[model samples]
Target: MSGKPKLHYFNGRGRMEPIRWLLAAAGVEFEESYLEKKEDLTKLQKDGSLLFQQVPMVEIDGMKLVQTRAIANYIATKIDMYVEGMFDLNELLMMYVIQPADKKEEYFANMMDKAENRYFPAFEKVLKDHGKDFLVGNQLSRADVQLLEVILMAEEYNPSILAKFPLLQSFKARISNIPTIKKFLQPGSQRKPRTTEEDVARAMKIFRS
Candidate 1:
């Protein structure tokens, strides 16, 4: 790797927050490069700097890694925070729910069924069986950090949404209490997710294309 890793993304959290959380949890120093306008993206795409014409790119080891999940996975692996051989049910469910609006109705219906009948129960079982504070093993992993963001966003919509999932609520509380993560929550440490319905609608329109 270079002297320090570099991340490129928009000023908004978008897909970069999870990568930020992973870096913070690992106690790694890094640099951020934020794009300000559509022209910035276009310019990057015109060159080969942006492979997919997207932000959330990470520059490390003289290479640029594209895609949010891929970059997060790479960082998690570098810091040894990734849980090997484990598929995160919550993450899978989230991917399904947050897909493009064209098929969102169908995907959301499937997500609800999986969440109620399979995903949540499996997560609860893992917690009860392992008696651990985190989702995977005893220690916090990228999965936990990623899940915390999701839970936080959900709570924005309904404050008591997690009440039905006591184990998940407890897990979220535990992770939020971590010193690094607690510091991350302080005002201005990070950008808040774009929450307005119009902002979300516009974002979805771009995403669907």
Candidate 2:
């Protein structure tokens, strides 16, 4: 891309949020065009901006990209296996976030069980076995960013979730302190807040309209 990539999505975090995390981790500054109303999305469709009539689209490198995975893959160029696993964890978290209030308790319990037992342990072992600051290599990669994002998300659900996994606790501390990511973590950065019930209602109105 000649200029900074321009992202199209709602104001709140959704599938696009991870793309923001990845770009920030890579130290890239980008622009966003939030769809504040249904007409905003309709106009994009009318103009053929969306190939599949979806948001979370990006304008970059003389191309319009859609599909969350495709956008992340293009940004990452080559995704590590560990990065893919971390994305799976992110999806599980997103599912819980968007669940109906009545269903959230059961969903949260199940998600936490899988995260603590299945997901967190696997990445903890990766960090421990490698004995490095990053998961896949000596340097940072999408895997590291993805892991950090998920760790924060998991912690938002349970502040003490990482207590059992000391290595992951250290990993979170280490990756989050990186200068680029650290900047993104600061207030007034492009990073979005945790999804709220109002966000879900707003999104429902936008898409259903």
The candidate scoring highest on lDDT is 2
Q: What digit string (tens of lDDT, one per residue) describes model 1 on residues 148-190?
A: 7766755554466566688987888888889888888778776
lDDT tens readout by residue for model 2, 1-209: 47899999999888999899999999889999988889989999999999999888999999999998899999985656787788888889887867887999999999999899999999989888999988876998888888899999988999999989999988888888999999999999999999887898888777885
Show model 2 residue runs off by greater than 4 Å.
none
Worst 10 residues of 2 by lDDT: 77-86
Which candidate leads the pack in TM-score? 2
TM-score of each: 0.73, 0.95
lDDT of 2 at 1: 48
Question: What residue runs in model 1 are displaced by over 4 Å at the alpha carbon?
Answer: 78-118, 197-209
